[model samples]
Target: MIACSAELYCAADLLTRASLGELDVDIVAIVSDKPAAGELAAQHGVPFRLVDGGLAGDSRAEQEAAFAAVLDELEPDLVVLARYMRILPEAITVRWNGRMINIHHSFLPAFAGAKPYHRAHQRGVKLIGATAHYVTAELDAGPIIAQGITPVSHRDEVEDLVRKGRDVERTTLANAVRLHLEHRVLVWDNRTCVFA
Candidate 1:
């Protein structure tokens, strides 16, 4: 697994699972656009690469080339975007279409991007959730693999929702990764047929 993230929670969960033999993944290396994830990788004894939004170099084509070179060097079977902040270029997305997945902090197709908990709170939603899906070029609109929700009330602040959402994200992302690795997910027409 090659996890890309600026935060440590998801990557830490994955690394811990792999260490405990709970997940059947090696977690060979970690790539991040930020240094926080690099610190986590170091703690876990995994190789770390600091790429610019998972791509390196100054120009678009050069960045793509650098991304390709990194992937080529790692030869990862799967790439997990564990709350990776930057938007990936389309070429990279297309190149690893089926082999990549991402954990979005919202239930998806609703609060698709950025500060989803805040939006959810503003809308007075009764439940906050997380979505894990294939990393298509179309943001969070990719085929959904797993979703989890936690009930919330008017009394719940944004921080409360974020806290609850993180737990959901962790579990949902892990489940999606497990399904993908176990060959239980089948994709067709931008939708997923998960056998779990």
Candidate 2:
């Protein structure tokens, strides 16, 4: 399992649960570009590697090389982006394709860019949700595997929506990862059929 995020305290908790036999998966390694993230990885007792040049500034070649190095070293069957917050280059996306998964903070095709929760709120949408999908070259556009929705009341603010959306994000991502690991997801025409 790959843990990415400053608030990966959630990821750490999930990893601990998995380690305690709550989930039938092996977390081979954890990667982060932040020092605090690395500290959290250490607290979880998992080996950690730091990606070079952070996420945004790194050129396509640099980012791809860094991820490729990790893939070569870890040899994971799949790469899960647990809030890594980086737009992967097409070269890397094509290389991993269906094997790479990402969790987006919106129901997707709805708010496909940054600050999706805020966008949903600004648009006065009745519901805010999260989507889990395969990593594709085009931004958040990908084959959607699963999604979770939460009711957004008129009383809710952007922060409230974001907080609720984070819950859905974690669950959606974990569900998608589980389905992918079990070989229960099939992609067709920019969507997915999950059998579980």
Clashes of each: 0, 0
User: What is the C-alpha lDDT profile of model 1 across 57-169, one tens digit per residue?
Assistant: 36646545656778889889999988877677888889899998999999888899899999999999999899999988888888999999999999999999999999999
Task: Output the number of the TM-score-best candidate.
Answer: 1
Writing each residue's lDDT as its tens digit, candidate 2 over 1-196 gives 5847565744664586677776567778787766567777777688888774545687657765886788777877788788877677787788888988888889988999888888898899998888889999999889998899999898999989988988888888878877887899989978888897
Candidate 1: what lDDT?
Answer: 0.85
lDDT on C-alpha atoms for all candidate structures: 0.85, 0.80
In model 1, what are the clashing residue pairs, if there are any? none
Best-matching candidate per lDDT: 1
Question: Each candidate: RMSD to true structure?
Answer: 2.2, 2.2
What's the true lDDT of residue 100 in model 2?
Answer: 86
lDDT of 2: 0.80
Report how far residue 56 has shifted in candidate 2, in Å: 13
